[model samples]
Target: MTGTELVIDGVTLTAGAHCLVEDVSLTARPGEVIGLVGPNGSGKSSLLRAVYRALRPATGRVGVDGADAWSLPVRQLARTVAAVVQESGAEFDLSVREVVAMGRTPHKRLLDGDTAEDAELIRSALAVVDATDLAHRSFDRLSGGERQRVLIARALVQQPSLLVLDEPTNHLDIRHQLDVLGTLRRLSATVLVALHDLNLAAYYCDRLYVMRDGKVTASGPPAEVLTPHLLARVYGVASEVIVHPRTGAPQVTFLPGAPALATRVEADPSAS
Candidate 1:
């Protein structure tokens, strides 16, 4: 599937009279993976909510392919943007396959049945997510990690031009987290994902958007954006920046309570 360019221009979000995010602007270029990262309650999720129309902006625009996103009908929008959110709740006892099949809803009519191609897509998604064995199990019985994998599989089956995910690696083991992110890196769809792990954001994302107190504090290539000074200023944590010898990505090493002592200890062999 081809990717769509996503632009959030001067977007401001609010809850009643309280502003959640202020004048945030960013972009996910076609076929690129952009990472959103900030401390909890920094308004990363709020901004994503506006992009997917779960919440409307007070003043600004969210556009896909250079057209206004909020102007499109829900079904039309769903067909182009697929999302996997952290709060994906369901009380029903649908089978895993059934849960994944729901992603195809936007492409089908009210009376249309699942075609062979649809079944194949479902199976392929399951396989890619390593959930093929759980396809017959009840979705409600799965663990949080299992449910996450299934939900991402569902998103993949939708095959949309843009993918928006919030904390997609929440509750995942290290291996599964890497696997899921690796899959995203290979996909053609433009991805706009919020992540809590700075290391993963650096390793997986093509670029990084650092948010702080409802503003775009920093944004650029991962190496350029993830600096010690910026991290200290925005995250309030002293860190040392290093380059990964293998991948050449920026790797952040946060200092402990005492920054000066931590540096000396790191340099001293006896501290190990």
Candidate 2:
């Protein structure tokens, strides 16, 4: 099956009397990368949870490929949208390959045995994330970045139309960060990623959604949404927006406040 398109229409997620997300609506088209950006408590994770069906909306609807997301069977949804979340704890002693193979579960019968084709897919997915070298390694023994790559490979093996990733670059070093995002950019599937790094978001995302206090404050192409004013207002940090020399993407540099600026300039006369 082809990858799916995701649409959130007037969705509201409430917990007790508090609305964690309010009337949030967005569409992720096939083959597009949409970055979700917000402060720590700004509902970025909550909204993503709704997309992955971790939390159902209190009002409105989420649709996948023109069908209501809730109406799809759990197994079917698993095949359509694969996610890599922030939490990566697994209490099992499964090997990296075994963990990635679990992505094939939705495609198999209850007691179905793994086929040669399943093994091939698993290998291919591992290669995509550069985890093939660690295939036989125990997941628990791997470093945080390694484990994250394994989880991403598992998601890739699911062959979903839409991929949702939460802070995929969190534990990765600079090179791995670029490598992972670069891989996502080359994939055909639609991607909705929650990102804290505005520079990385600008580098990989086709468009961006800026959330503030559980509401979507602005959304558009990275160049348009990542303006100085928007960053200052939403993130409470003054930033300078510049165009990337090679890619023409928006590059953001946070402006240090008075104290840090004085220290830096005083330390080096040419720094300013």
Candidate 3:
């Protein structure tokens, strides 16, 4: 399947009585990569959850291929969208291959078994991430970085038209981070990924949305959004936005000072 557009319109996500993210609207064009960037407790993850339908929006709609995500059946939605989340359940004792194979579940009919095609797709996914040799390893036993790559492979096998990932580079080293982002660059899917690395987001994403205090303060191409003034206003930091010599994307280098956020060390987890 080819890529399809993803739209989150007038979305408000809440946790308990607190509004985590309010009235956010964004779009990921077909086969385009969009970045979500913000400080911790800025509601990046909360907004992503609503896109994948793991969390329902308090008000607004998430549209995939011009259809309402909330109106679609869960199974149908899964087939169209796949997600790689931070801190997936820790108790599963499955092997790397088993975890990857689960990506096919959305496609299988009830009481049906895996087809030979499914096996090939699973193997292909592992190869794409260079995790083919680790197929027999216990998933729970892998290092955090290894587990991240495996989870990405699982999403790859899903063959989704729209892929949602929350901090997909969480545990990766610099090399793996580049490798993984390169992989996303080659995929024929609409991608909305939450990233803490501003440089990487600028390098990989076609457009970006900067969230601040549960709202999007800016959204545009990296060049327009990564200005020093915006950084100071939203991230409460001092930085210089420079043109990358190679990619021409915006690069931010921190100045010698602490950010100005009040209560930087600890924030209400519910707001995030």
Compute each candidate's TM-score over C-alphas. Answer: 0.94, 0.92, 0.93
| lDDT ranking of the models | 1, 3, 2
Tens-digit lDDT track for model 3 on 1-272?
Answer: 56889988999998899999999999999999999999999999999899888889999999998999989998898998999999585755999999999999999988788899999999999988888899999999998989999999999989999999999999899988998999998899989999999999999999999999899999999989988778888977877776766666777777767544222122233543
lDDT, model 3, position 171: 88
Stretches off by above 4 angstroms in model 2 are: 258-272
Q: Which regions of candidate 3 deviate over 4 angstroms? A: 258-272
**Candidate with best TM-score:** 1
Q: What TM-score, to 2 decimals, does candidate 3 have?
A: 0.93
In angstroms, how far off is 129's CA in candidate 2?
Answer: 1.4
**Residue-by-residue lDDT tens digits, candidate 1, 1-272:** 68999999999999998989999999899999999999998999998888888999999999999989999988999999999987898754899999999999999999788999999999999998889999999999999999999999999989899999999999889988998999999999999999999999999999999999899999999988887778777877778877766666777789876343222111333333
Write down the worst ten-residue block by lDDT for model 1. Answer: 260-269
Residue 29 alpha-carbon offset, candidate 1, angstroms: 0.9
The true-versus-predicted C-alpha distance at residue 200 of model 1, in Å, is 0.8
lDDT of 2 by residue, 125-214 (tens): 898888889999999999999999999999888888899999999899998899899989988999999999998998899899999999
User: Alpha-carbon error at 144 in model 2, in Å?
Assistant: 1.0
RMSD of 3: 7.2
